[model samples]
Target: MPDTSQKAGGRRNAQSRREDQPMYPATLKVAVIHWVMLCAVASTVAQTVDLSGEWRFKKGDDASWRQPDLVDTDWQPISTGSPWEQQGHPDYDGFAWYRRRFTVPTALRDAEAFALTQSLLLSLGRVDDVDETWFNGQRVGGHGTFPPNYAGDWQAHRSYVVPNALVRWGEANVLAVRVYDGSGMGGLLGRRPLLRAATWREVVRLEWEPGLGDGLFTAPRPIAFQATLHNDSPRALSGDLHWSVEDDEGKELSRSTVAVALPAGRATPAVHSFQPSSPGFYKFVATLEPVDGTKLLFSKFTGYLPESIEAPLTREPDFDAFWKETLATLAAVDPQFAVERKIDRDSATHEVYEIAMRSLGGVRVRGWYEKPKTGNRSPVLLRVPGYGQNMRPTGSDAPIAFFSFNVRGHGNSQQDVSGLPADYWIRGLDDKRGYYYQGAYADCVRAVDFLAGRSELDPQRIGVTGGSQGGGLSLATAALDPRISLCAPNIPFLCDWVKYFKASHWPEMDKWIEARPERTWETTLKTMSYFDTLNMADRIRCPVLFSLGVQDPVCPPSTVFSVYNRLGGRKEFRAYPNDAHRVNGAHRAVLNAWIGREFSRPAK
Candidate 1:
């Protein structure tokens, strides 16, 4: 078996705090303590501790033993375990065990005085689900059942307390674990488990980087505001920063424009102070227009202006020019046929419309629309599909105007763009103008437009739902438009993009790293911020339901929690330890039941 244990002295040195990094003055003391802890942990290794590694594994359905003290020669090396990649073995549903042997270091013989702990981390990739972990011959900790039907915890980390008596100093120790993936893309997609000496430093390192910061709301003041733009790139950049303030009616209040220049590797903060003549709720936006005339970067920040002044609309006739050009470009391309003619009928209980929207970008996007057959108008349910599939409403009999859409490069909607191989991660990657996410957002808006166009549809009662990528779209759409009344995203993707690159091993994301390898981590993250749900969650005006699987390997529960905590509206969440990407049958029942009740009620 290959030794998977980490080298004791090979760990990277602790990182020093970057000078340019922002810090909350009040938390300086806490930050200092974290640095100290990292230093101490890096300097020590526990003596007489047996670290787990050199693992072997086997596939099975039974969990009869908590501790496998007896050796089974039938077991194969975990690295070569069954269910080869092509078979999609186990179909991402089933059970497997990992066993490793380790020898204790003789440095500390008084093992009983110090606590021994074991921890395992798994990454299933894309899908979120539950898992159960074991150590040596004992049940340690797991979110789901020890053997079957375990409720999911959806957490990336699982730990087990080591019995003091189980420590055999200076001897070989066997560590074993059992993992279960219930749905979606499940399996060991990235990273692996290894052993480390547990100490206070380790505990402190875990505590460092206090989750996310709270939203800071400035007191109502003059509309005048200053923006400090920092150009942290190596090459000189030039752009025009367009600024505008708008009222609640979507009317412009005041506007200013500035052209900016920054030398290579420098910082510049532009100050814009303006007074609004009138206000309800105001927004300030800054858009970058590059010198080469290429739309390289587009960024904006919003704030409110007091309603005391009577501000008039500052009309910019040129604004429509951009929209006109965009619309003209879209009209030039023929919309590819998405679906053939189907039946449109009204029954006693439902009104069904066989609908088809062209996949202008090549990926065919298709779906069905069903409304209440009765005279009463029905709310819309905009369902976003997960990775590799188009949205298709399932297991529901409610009267809903369903608009299921395929993102730009998927399904029947592939129009102007070439068809991407089912597994192409970098498809449409080189050109940001045609990237999957760029068109995906547009698809969401088009879906809304389609629903709103129908006279029988109750636009005010429309809602959105999806899992994984679909869940992410739900949050993004809700933030961009207030028309959505409710949203439910399950194990959503594309939250904190910066953190995702560090935590995930999804092969598709490698294109991002390759495009800008030197500052790929930083640049890709900044680009992702434009699409991050955390930044948009505050803008959402509707109620939301967020679900997570504790044992999920792809979308870590912690990341989901980070976004859920930032939501600024009515919100509720559920965590399943044994479940993965798709919730179990029982949980799905609860979800649909809640939706039926909420959607049926009159809008607030």
Candidate 2:
């Protein structure tokens, strides 16, 4: 059984209360009390000035533009928080200038004159590449050196402090920024710029790291709860750090309260350790708040989960029958294979062929077929693509026949179906027979059928491989077709739909579910059971190789293990500790070696 307790502190929002999890609100109750306490010490004195309006933009470099009195009446008007590509400069590179004028608040000027405020911090969000900012006529701050030795901090969030002398009290201030983008999209591509008190923002950072060695946490492992209290305000923060650990189901397992004082303009680190009694998912949440103040310094969440977890199958009653009938329907159609030789994609070692074949519902699917020029019979490797991706020619130099298959609703096959994911994934969900993946899975089986019919390919040594949606199709193809002898799936999707619907990290699924309240969970699960890879796991008889990431939010690691645990074939599994949907390069090397070794062996 897949333990929800294991994912307690996993991906997404930790404080989320699921239908299956317990409803005891230890954190919620504490939050209410904290809110009341924060209401007692109210003091709002800091001021914030918004500088996000239209700015005068001029392309190319000019040192004279940075001057406070420079005129830019002919410059184009552009808004912040949008990339230059979206602002009619799609291919623009090199230096560009953005100039904006804003009036300083009278109150802020008065406070500065009386020396009541610390300093003014200009928050410029994130600038793609490098930038130099000038307030009035003086240089306030800059990130990265310009020109020949340009070292661009492309993803840096810029925060520059303006010197007290630079402020022309209550007057209009000219803020000129010179930005250089090295490649692709650039310019102000993040949050809008703003001017605020240096001591207004306070932050609390939380990180949960394992106290022991990496990889799967088998049982009774120690986890460290690290919290850093940051006091950006000029004042100190004296508060109690209320931290707790809850099972995946939101039941409080442990709690702690530490009274500490945070100094002004500094970060203080606090460390706590807890050993889980057994193996499961748990969440560690920390909230730092002053005893009698309205400022809730921090209430952040992080998880402490096992490396591996398993989920139950959401199997339909006719799971086998549905696929059996679907494949039978595909077999009924004559796969009129249209093979066109592509000279451009061909090499001296391999001959490339663009193949189009008829699949279920008469949809024409496409694939790039590459076979060794000198070989009459070679092992066939069928590669599928990730979600919505078109199948392209393989870059592999392996001595094998490679067929990159693009199922219906993808690549050239989209002539009859939409390529948009939201349109396809939920299409025909009203009936299991008309579900989109039924045709997609049939298309995969048809790809295998095409390989089996080719005389130059070894039908007995055909294998399937892909990542994400491709990974799910790989498993489904091997399960539906007996011609496939080996299969490797990486971070596969469309598995454990029941579990996925409960806590889906993907926005599309949530939006789909939220858009239709009448469908309910029961109806959705029934329709998904037909496409769930977990239900098809038991059907795959070939040697299986699976890889999944521990921190994968799109396809939960627990649901992936459900498919792995249910497989009744020779199989191997690998888990990447700090990966999301994609695995690392080292694992890719191992996967290639494994597939090569599998193809080299005799057909079972």
Candidate 3:
């Protein structure tokens, strides 16, 4: 169970109520509070400089902005309005210029000068790619690389500094933006991209009245946190609030009870205090128990803590010792398949090598490798970039042989495993044997075999890493084959099959669940145990590096953390708060750095 006895210190005092505070305030205080609230509302609803008017756009190979001096019309607006509306055209694959004219307020001429900021926030509410911003024909900051797949999510609001000279403070200003959407649903499909002055309101107003509040909390202590409940409706509502807490390992810690009786249109705050005795990530769930004993109004919260002196680290061996024990355990299970591999060659520039290995079926699997150019025979990293028809070697130079393998169902090896789609997730999910995971795992084992066949690569210096379904393969390979030196899986899917089937809101999984009503979750999950990374993570011997995104609806953070805490080996984890499955370039850099460092260390 979690330890909830830790005192709520200065962090709580920042917003907690004082014992001597009055329930209601004096007239003067009330007046001041009302005035403040009114001011806040007014600021939120203040006139927004709508920059969505008629705009001109052009596409070019270079960044040169054609000035009026070079064009026929100096003041006329050049429009590509019709062609721009027809999205998804092959011509839309490149950059385009967008021009919008807005009249500046004359009264605000002398007011603090502000530059126009253009941001693409939440494109079409589904797909997210990268884009750039320009104001008055001047360059501003942007996230990600230029052109398609620009590295930044549409949900993220990017602000770039505009030159003061470019701003027509009180006159009409021309705002142009060059956007690039690489794949999937490209272009601005939903709402228009927003353009605003530098000085704009940022506070978000959340109104709450009676059943449940937003899923946010502040953990004053390791195990205990407080939550606010509000009743927005005009009637009193009564319900039992059930709260439960679980650690990263899916171990239930402590839970507290609370009953709420909120008046109509009034708000109530409930504080949950639980004990989290562990020093890892913890999840808290609050549910409004139905009168008929059903569950409703569910919300989740997560918290973590650094290691403390009082709680001695669990009696787990260090990474090397753990891997040795893991190998020994797996060896005890089946001595016929010893855990060892060999590397053949190490490249100088491209870091490419070749490996040959005999699979369990006695068929040899081939692999291409790329090791860190740092001149060190560091731990090896085996990667399978998924079933794409053009899967290639990734991470050419790092601290390890970032060997990316094209599994049998993908790339040059597709003939070996046929009938699988280039994109396999949506293909034959109902069939247990023919499912993508089946062949994928075989390819993973082959990858390890290829590594073992090599003479230059170290057998004990092998790790596996990948994302999405590839992540699932990493876990399965590590579980079925103990030769993997370390494992790093990022936002992997296909874990905790029961929970995933129930919690996922995606169309693909929803269709699968509905079509297979006869397939009980228990049966499906049992079958999935063979592929579930979380279940397999515990079986992995090497230290694992896990990364998760808090806002990822696809592979929810809860599932990731569930597997992370249960891993019975040396582990390190990081969560990007506002990111989804595909993280930003900066975060990717951090992940690469961590992998480099982990592989650089000598095997224990």
Question: TM-score, each model?
Answer: 0.45, 0.61, 0.51
Scored by TM-score, the top model is: 2
Error of 2 at 455 (Å): 2.8
lDDT of 3 at 65: 49
Better of 1 and 2 by TM-score: 2
Candidate 2 deviant stretches above 4 angstroms = 1-208, 211-215, 220-242, 246-255, 259-280, 287-310, 374-376, 505-518
Candidate 2: tens digits of C-alpha lDDT, residues 437-499: 888888998898889989988888998988888789999998888889999888888787866
Ranking by TM-score: 2, 3, 1
Q: On lDDT, who's better, 1 or 3?
A: 1
The sequence of per-residue lDDT tens digits that candidate 1 reaches over residues 415-477 is 544334543234444443455665676567556766777787888888887777777889888
Q: Candidate 3 lDDT, tens digit per residue, 460-548?
A: 87778666555667777877688887787766666655455544544444455567667554554544554566555567777777766
Q: Candidate 3: where is the Cα deviation over 4 Å?
A: 1-172, 175-348, 351-368, 371-379, 386-390, 418-436, 505-518
RMSD of each: 18.6, 11.3, 16.9
